[model samples]
Target: MLEEEYQPRRELPPHLRKAPAPEAPFSYELRDAVLADMPAVREIYNYYVANSTVTFDEDRKSLREWKSKFTYLQKLGMPFIVAEAPSGQLLGYALVSPWKQKRAYRFTVENSIYLGPAATGKGLGRVLLGELIDRSKAAGLKEMIAVIADQGAESSVALHEKFGFTEVGRMGRVGYKFERWLGTVMLQRSLK
Candidate 1:
């Protein structure tokens, strides 16, 4: 091997290193999601599906699938909302779906929240979740559940806990994604 190839990589001196670019100021409003927002919502979700363990879905979802989900939530009178920038860009989304199809489970729902990469860590999740809880309560939902991945999703766990969700149970090695076995942590909160 050449000497250049054998040499270890060198780090830049602190003074010579480039600083990270400052994030642009951001703001958004939350509203009920429309059919038109499916494309943007799909994009945000597919990003996590393709790049992270946040979601166990390995295949990218199609627009048709998103549209179907939107319609299903609509028919069920579930809360499906989005955060939009002043310029009409979707920053994130939150929704609740029936936790189970059994009649006994009608009053319980599973919550899902996803944010665009640039929209995370800016308090958007807190706002979205807070509003989702309020809407679910208004809709007569009595229980909300969050199924979060055990790996690569610590922030999600913390966020749910902040909203008073408590660990109900856990399933180990229930998912296989990205060449690894994954597990889930279940958290529950009461609306009543």
Candidate 2:
């Protein structure tokens, strides 16, 4: 055996390598978000904002804005969960927020979920959303909503269907991005 061939490999540079998407068994536990989770949460959320229609914003959010979001969730007593691997890394996050600002809209909320690049298509998203629904119902919310970008074209819609959400409305050319307009679809799942 050549001595040089026995050495362990070091981390490869981005251009020369690929990383595996994180996956675990279909089951994952959810916990309340904590201050310590801000960095990982910011990283995962910004990744989607930068690379996909899962989030519509063109610009990544600052840490201060992240903190403000966290504060809003806290004030609403909404569930903000960080899904974790058995080894304890933050795999993804799911959250619920006020569907509309009016007092009449207080009983409804919108849910959002995002996974790290390496964590997609592994069934983790479904688990996080299921948990979020349970939390919303427990909080006495009447309906859970999903507003999906037309270009999203992924499980964001399918997952909602699996949970019994029905398409309630659609808007044509409601969003402009990437030099074009995109439609929007809204789905709602009744909790009562």
Candidate 3:
């Protein structure tokens, strides 16, 4: 949970404010997330929660809370993967979790992807998501959905489009963050 004085979603500290300048291609590997990667995972997620409307949650979660969520995903056998640079930096992560808990919804999943603030615009998202799609299919998932919280996230939307996801729905003014009414766009693709 965030303190009462937490920064508004629209206003972030300099480091978390914008995508860093793009860097030359670097060595990176896509692999299954380990129990030790939760801190890096939390760091990336908390940035979005605290600094942008990419996520609707306004409060940063504690490490314990995140580990609990991590464990739950593991229990469900959902995919959780991380992007690690050769230098040992955890650049980003992508995962799939249940879209809903109903028995009838077991074959569907919601996707979440996040990159380190400095790691944006470097094309890691494409790599992570491609691998995620392969793994999801291998796990026998029938559909994958992305609930994008910001309509202005062009890159994310474009990435999904490039991978065959189509805009299935939008809920305008459905979320209030940073003292403004925000919207959510949902995109989906079939795994089969």
Candidate 4:
């Protein structure tokens, strides 16, 4: 065998090395969602549905579906809110819908909070959830439930717990998504 020649590894020059990205200024205002906001809301939700197990939905939701939901929530006097940037771009959304269709379950609702990819890890979720809870209380809702996916949703579970939501139950392997079994952790909080 021929003898190998020695080679020296070269390091990139300081200016050539990649620098950390500068954080952009993030400011948003929370307000009640309007009919025009469904498209943006659908895009945000579809991102999770198509890419992560955080949502168990295997198919993307249509704009019509989102609009229908908005109408239903509006008719029920439920809280459906969005966070918008100064530039009028939607940052995220949070809502509470009836937990069950029965008349006896009218006082209870299930809460859902979804943030844009760029909006996570900046305490936006905390702000959104805080406002959601306050609005729910103002709407005379008595209880709020959170059904969180056990996989790829640890942050969601933690966020809910931080807001005084207690784990009421857990179901294992009850959902099949992404070619794998998934489970859910149910948490509940009293708005009263």
lDDT of each model, Cα atoms only? 0.97, 0.85, 0.91, 0.95
TM-score, every prediction: 0.87, 0.83, 0.86, 0.89
Clashing pairs in 4: none
The digit string of per-residue lDDT tens for model 4 on 104-183 reads 99999999999999888999999999999999999999999999999889999999999999999999999999899999
Predicted model with the maximum lDDT: 1
Ten-residue segment with the worst summed lDDT in candidate 1?
Answer: 20-29
Q: Give candidate 1's TM-score.
A: 0.87
The lowest-lDDT stretch of 10 consecutive residues in candidate 2 is 20-29
Q: Could you tell me how far off, in angstroms, the CA of residue 138 lies in candidate 4 after the best superposition? A: 0.3
Instruction: Give lDDT: candidate 3, residue 162.
Output: 96
Q: Write the per-residue lDDT of candidate 2 for residues 14-87, one digit (tens) a residue.
A: 88887778864555568998877888899998887777766778898888888888998888888899987777
Per residue, candidate 3 scores C-alpha lDDT tens digits across 31-55 of 9998899999999999998888889
Would you list the rank order by TM-score, best first? Answer: 4, 1, 3, 2
Candidate 3 similarity to native, TM-score:
0.86
Which candidate gets the maximum TM-score versus the true structure?
4
Distance (Å) between predicted and true CA of 103, model 4? 0.6
Badly placed stretches (over 4 Å) of model 1 are 1-24
Off by more than 4 A, model 3: 1-24
Number of clashes recorded per candidate: 0, 2, 0, 0
